[model samples]
Target: MLKIGLIGLGPIGSLHIDNLTSGAVKDAELSCVCDMRKVDNPKIADIPFYSDIDQMIKEGGADAIVIATPSFTHFELAKKCLLAGKNVLVEKPISLCTADAKKLEALAKDCGKICAVMLNQRTTPIYKRIKEMVSSGEIGKVNRVSWNMTNWFRPQIYFDMSAWRGLWKGEAGGVLINQAIHNIDAFAWIFGLPQSLRAWCKFGKYHNIEVEDEVTCYMEYPENMTATFITSSGEHPGSNRFEISGDKAYVVSEDGKLKIHKFVGGSLREFTLDTKYAFGTPETVETVEEFEGKGGQHAEVMNNFVSACLGKSKCDYDASQGVLSLTLANAMLLSSFKNSEIPVPFDDELYAKILAEKQASSELRKEVRKDFILDFKKSFR
Candidate 1:
């Protein structure tokens, strides 16, 4: 069995614990868990638990470490694991910034160890099929992409549960960094990273936090394509629609159903050039596909990570892929701060300065901290 060490005991972390103990991941066992809190919980009552990360790594005898702590702590924790020659898997939004993400990636490379991200959404069939459709040229030369994923609703009490829930100093960002990150990463994974971005972000518009809760971003891709990303934590009964328009077909996916309209014989360019009449277009066919069941979400990712550890395969979500979406998040936030379109791979120092300002501002504000309850089942839909 592949021995695994886990950090953090929050909702997400505890869920990982459950999956490992439940035999949801083949050939993997949760040998140790680390958190600052007392580890007498009945869920992990018999497992070895540590209050210190270093103690867990040094004495736990784990072959791999999974970091599920806060977003800002990922870099240091992952680095520690990598330097110690242990494979590390970090939760989403791999790091708050690009430089730190790259640093962990480099450390893993230097140590020749595995570093993966819990981008379980990538394993979903809807997105995987969509990626194959677009990348495989089934949707010819996609030009316009739009996703309005605003269903990630959060109440003020959710933010009040922790001082760092929606704050920039702790979580780094609000929606785009926290909830919409899966969609953002999926965007980068399917459509490729954009060349530039212009965005308008609303900080603390819906919650009593010091980071963005609402945002609208316009991104420019290199292949003469453009994309729009609109998200918020303020909207109720929101829609999760992702649309892509291409030269040969158009696609819209919503609620696990994918709809496509394809021109019969010619691409848009070919039809425009070869059409006999001014207003006539090529014939079209409509195809609809619906997907069901979570096709190996977090469990699938863990299975793959364990397989990689056993030399059966390589890690599916490497650290490089993990940082691609984070770069976009950083760019959009920086562009909103500057009130102008910013180039891809944003300036690290400038973003740090902006984040420092927000951190200082957040420190000045007084907020109530509610007791945190652990119930991972109700956390995600």
Candidate 2:
């Protein structure tokens, strides 16, 4: 069995502990857990617990380490794990800055250890089928893409539960970085990275947090295609719709269903060129597909990580893939900060410097609630 050590006792981290201890992940065991504060969960009562990561590392029973701590601590923790010759699976965004993310990725490579991200959405069938549809040319050349992912609503109490819940200095960003990051990563994974983007962000729009809670971004892709991303942490009963318009078909994903309208006769370009009438359009066929379940989610990722660490298979996703979405997030945040369109691989060091300035000047105070109960299901998309 592949031995695993878990860090952090938050909701996601707790979920990981449950999965490992419950035998939900094949060929893996939870050797230990670490958190800054003492964990009182009975699920891990028999497992070794440490308040210090260094102590856990020095104990050295785990073959792989899962870093599910807050966003700010990912870089240093992951770096330490990799340096200790441990495979790592870190939570999303990887780090608050792209520069740190790159360093962790490079370190993982130099250490010759597996480094993965908790991007569970990658295993979802809806997104995987959508990727195949678009990449297989079933939707022709993608002309435009739009995703309105505002269903990630968070209340004031949610931010108050933790000191770093919604602070720029703490989480780096609010909705885009924390909540909508899964969708953003899916977008990048399915459609590939954008060439440039322009964005508008509202800081503390619907919440009292200093970071952005509302954002609208327009991204430019190659082949004359474009995409728009709109998200917020303030909207209630919000819509979660992703639409893509292609030359031969139109695709939309909403309410756990994928709808495709495939045009008959020919692609839009051909139809426009050879149409007999000025206002006539091509015939269309519609197909709708609904998905059930969350495609195994976090457990599936951890299982795969275990298999990778055991040399049974290659890691389905790794830190290298995690960096793509981080780059997109960094570019959009930088674009909104500069009030201009920014390139895809924008200046990572420059963004890091600006984030440092923001962190240095932040004046937000928090009422950290150690007694607050966490509801992990509500946080899922």
Candidate 3:
């Protein structure tokens, strides 16, 4: 078994505790825990709990650590563990900046320890099937990928409840980085990274926060494929829809169902050139599929991390996958901020300059607020 210490007891961290204790993850034990606030759960009533992370790092009993902390604290926390030669599983976006994320990646490689991210959306069977189909040419040359994930609706109190909930200096970014990032990760998983992008985002569109809540971006990928991504916390009764239009088929996943239409004829380009008809489309076959049952999301991520640490299996949710999502989010953000199209492989230094400038003026109100809200259920794309 892989002895584990989970740091941070935020809502997600607390949920993870239940999952880990429920025997959902095989070959794992939540032997230790550390959080700034008191963890009063019955599940971990006897496990080691520390209010200070440094103390836990020094004396906590564990072979590996799971970082379920805030966005900005990931790199530093993982840095300590990597230096200690312990495996780590960090939450999404990995680090606030690509450079910082890269540093952890290099450190993990240098230390020869397993480092994974909590991209649990990848564990979803629907997305798993989508990735398999795209890789198997079921889509046959993706030409357009558009995802409108506007279902993340947050009220003002939700933002004001925590200082780092939605600030550039705090949570590092908003919708694209925080809420709809699963979609971003899923997009990258299915389509890979794009070559260039142009984005537009609105700050504080519906809340008192200092980061973007509404965003729309256009991106271009390899082989002239293109995509449009839009997300918002401002729209109520919003919709979660993912659409991918490729040469051979069009697939969409929405409302808990997967729908696809496969073209029976040759590629559209070939048909367009050979056909004598002015405007006629090819015959197509449509299929709709749905997946049932859950697959141990967060717990599965932890189990995979433990298995990888034991050299039994490799964790696919490594720093590269983490960086891919962060890179796309950062590119969209920097592009929107500069009001210019940004090329792929964005300049990390330039992004640092931009984020620093934004941080310079950001004023996140400090307060002795409630550390944890007991209601532990929420959803996002």
Candidate 4:
């Protein structure tokens, strides 16, 4: 059996502990847990707990480590775990910058250890089906993609719950990196990376924070394809609409439903060229699918990790795939910061330097409330 150690006791960390102890994952047991703060829970009353991660590493009980710590600490903690010869499963936005993320990826390869991230949204059935359809060319040659995903509404008290909630030095970014990264990852998973992008970001637009809470980005892909992503954390009753237009079909995913309209005549180019009339249109068929369950979510991801560690199956994905989401978020922010379109695979060093500058200039603040309780399930995408 693969013994898993979990770090951090924050909201997400608590969720991981519950999932591990609830017997949801097969062939794995919670061997130990570590956090800087005092851990007081009956769930882990019989389990080993450490205040220091180094101590946990030295004791050598767990074969794998799950890092659910704050975003800023991901790199160092993951590196330490990897160097200590432990497989790692870290939370999303692997690191603040692409450079550190890439370094972690390379080090994991060198260390010969499994390193994965918690991009659990990929397990959602609707998205999985969409990816399959797109990859199968049910939607042929995507021409345009637009997503207005602003359902992640947050109040001031939400940010006030933690000191590191919205600071660049703490969370690295706001909605783009913190809340919308899963969507960005899902988008990249289905559509792949874009060539260039222009973006606009509004920092602390609706809250008393130091990072972006609203963003609009326009990206250009190869073959004359384009995409638009708009999101905000301050909008209430916001919509989560994603649309894709291709030569043969158009797809819309929203409100836990997917709608596809397939063209009957031929490709749009062919129809346009062959039609003699100026207002000619092609015959189309529409289909809609609704989802009631959220799939396995975090539990599914951990199960995959355990099976991969035991060589039972290939890992669904690892931290190496996490770079694209981070890169996309960084590029959008960098474009807004410079007021210019940034290219894909932008200079990693430049992004790191800019992040360092922001951190250096950051005026960290204290949390307004320490007893605020959070329901992790409510935050699931």
Candidate 5:
């Protein structure tokens, strides 16, 4: 059996534990769990638990490691695990910066170890079908793509649970890094990366966080194809919808349903019998598809990672793919902060310069107080 070690015991980490122990991996066993907090659950009672990750990896005798820690720590932890000669599965937004992500990718290649990212949305049947349809030219040339994902709502209590909740220096970016990363990944999966991006984001709009809460980004692609991404954490009764329009048909996802409107040949009667009606005449037909699954993206991600470890399949969201989405997110944030369009294949030098300036700014630096640092450290412990 493939022995595995899981780090971090937060919500997502707990979900991975459940999946690993709940027969999600027929040939795998969760031999060890390393978290700062003590878990008393019966599921993990017999397994080894350690506060130090490196010690647990050495003493617990695990063949692979799953890093479910916060986004900022992903790079360092994943690197450490890979250096120890263990396969790794890290949660999304692989790292806070693109350069770190690239370095990890190169390290994994050198070590010849499996490195995967938890982008579970790609495993959904609905999204997979949508990708197939788009790839097969069922929609012809895509003219426009729009995603409205504003349904994410996290209260102050959720933020209060950790000091690194919404600060740029701590969590990197705001909603784009935390809540919208999945959608951003999905967009890139369905439609390739954009050549350039222009965005406007509101910092500390609803909550008292230092990161952004509302954002609107415009992505430009070749051949005049464009996409608009609109998201907010401030609105209630929000909606999650996506619309893709092409020359032959259009697809829309809303309220857990996918509707496709395709232009087909007119019916025999319509073509034979001349109808004077203009507005009532129907030239297209609509089809709706429904899907049902665990709905928890984390579970799906874990299952894929385990499958990859067993050589049964490959990871749907590999670390390299995750880097693309993260790069796009970083570009958007940089564009919003600079009030200009940021070119893709991101300018690392410009991003570094901006980060340095932000870190040195006295007004922004004041937000990281002693209490904030304590709370942030508590979560990692």
Candidate 6:
């Protein structure tokens, strides 16, 4: 059985604990939990509890570590875990910056450890089906794509709850990084990387934060295909719909329903029966489909991570995959700030330079919540 150590007992971390002990991993146990907050579960009474992550790893006898800390601290925590010869499963976005993500990826390679990210959207069966359909020519050649994800709304209290809420230094980014990242990753999974990206963003549109709340990005691909991503945290009664048009048909997923419009034939003919003197019917027809599943995203990601740890399967949302999504997000931010089209596989140096400039200009301040930082320090000591 694989013994796991969980760091950070936040909501996501607690969810992982349940999954680890809830038969999700047939041969896994939550042998240790390290967090600043004291664990209260009776089941974990016998298990080791340490406020220090490094100390826990050294003495807990764990085979893997799940790092569910804040986004800004991912790099340091993951690096430490990998260096300690432990497999790591980090939450999404990997790191606040692309350079740090790349460095972590390289470090994982050197350590020869399993580094995975929790990009749970890729585990959805509906998205899997759609990917197969598109790749198998069922949708023919994709001509255009669009995703509108304005349903993610966050209140001011959420940002105010922690000091590292919406600023560039702490959260690193706003809707694009924290909220729309799932959709952005889904986009990359459905369609390959775009040739270039251009975006316009409104920083702190509704909230009193220093990061963007609304953004619209334009992506161009080969074969004259294009895509648009529009998202906002300020919209209420919003929409979460994705549409893709191809030569053969168009597919749409909106409000938990999937619809496809496939061309039947050329001529618009009518059929008449010997019944009442009714008019003819159109020849063309359309088909609509939908799917439902019990597994939530969190459960799916946890299961996948467990499978990967057991060598039963490989994770689709590995560290490298997370890097791709993060790079795209950083590109969007760069495009907005530079007021120019940013290319895919973006230059890491350019992003680093941008960050440095922001830091130097005092535009980005390290506004970490004192309590959170103190807790984190205590956990990592």
Residue range 1-381, candidate 6, lDDT tens digits:
778898988767877877777776567788899988897876667778999988998998999898988777788999999999998888888988889888888888899878888888876666777788789988777889999999878777667667566877667789999988888888888897899999998999989888899999999999999999999988997898889877666789876677877645422211223324366433434677777762357667766777778889886667888887888889899999899998887888888888766655434333433332223322210
User: Which RMSD values do the candidates have, in order?
Assistant: 1.8, 1.4, 1.8, 1.2, 5.2, 6.4
TM-score of each: 0.95, 0.97, 0.96, 0.97, 0.88, 0.88
Assess each prediction's global lDDT (C-alpha) against the native. Answer: 0.88, 0.89, 0.85, 0.90, 0.81, 0.80
Cα distance off (Å), candidate 4, residue 245: 0.3
Cα lDDT of model 5 by residue, 97-171, tens digit: 788888888999899888889887777677787799889988877889999999877665556556566876667
Please write out the lDDT profile of model 4 over residues 1-381, one tens digit for every residue: 999999998778888988999999889999998998877888889998899899998784999999999899999999999999999999987999999999999999999998899989898999999899889987898999999999889988787877788998888899999999999999988889999999999999899899999999999999999999999999999999999999999899998999988899758778878989899888889999898888888999999999999999998779767887998999999999899999997989998999999998885565367677777667666
Per-residue CA lDDT of model 3 for 1-381, tens digit only, reads 988899988778887898789888778899899987896788989998899877887788788999989887898999999998788999887988888889999999999988899998888888898899899998888888888888888877677777788888877799888888888888888788888999999989888788899999999988889999999989988988889888888899888789999888947667767888888887889999988854557877888888888889988888988998899999989998889999988999889788988888876768735654534456422
- The predicted structure with the larger TM-score, 2 or 3, is 2
Kindly indicate the candidate among 1 and 2 with the higher TM-score: 2
**Candidate ranking (lDDT, best to worst):** 4, 2, 1, 3, 5, 6
Is 1 or 5 the stronger prediction by lDDT?
1
Candidate 5 residue runs with Cα over 4 Å from true position: 265-282, 294-296, 356-381
Q: What does the lDDT come to for candidate 4?
A: 0.90
Model 3 global lDDT (CA atoms, 0 to 1): 0.85
Candidate 3 clash pair list = none
> Any runs in candidate 6 off by more than 4 Å, and if so which?
265-284, 294-296, 359-381
Best by lDDT: 4
Which segments of candidate 1 are over 4 A away from where they belong?
Answer: 39-43, 364-378
157-262 in candidate 2: lDDT tens per residue? 8888777878877899888889888998999999989989999999999987899999999999999999999998899989999999999899999999999898
Which of 4 and 6 is the better model by lDDT? 4
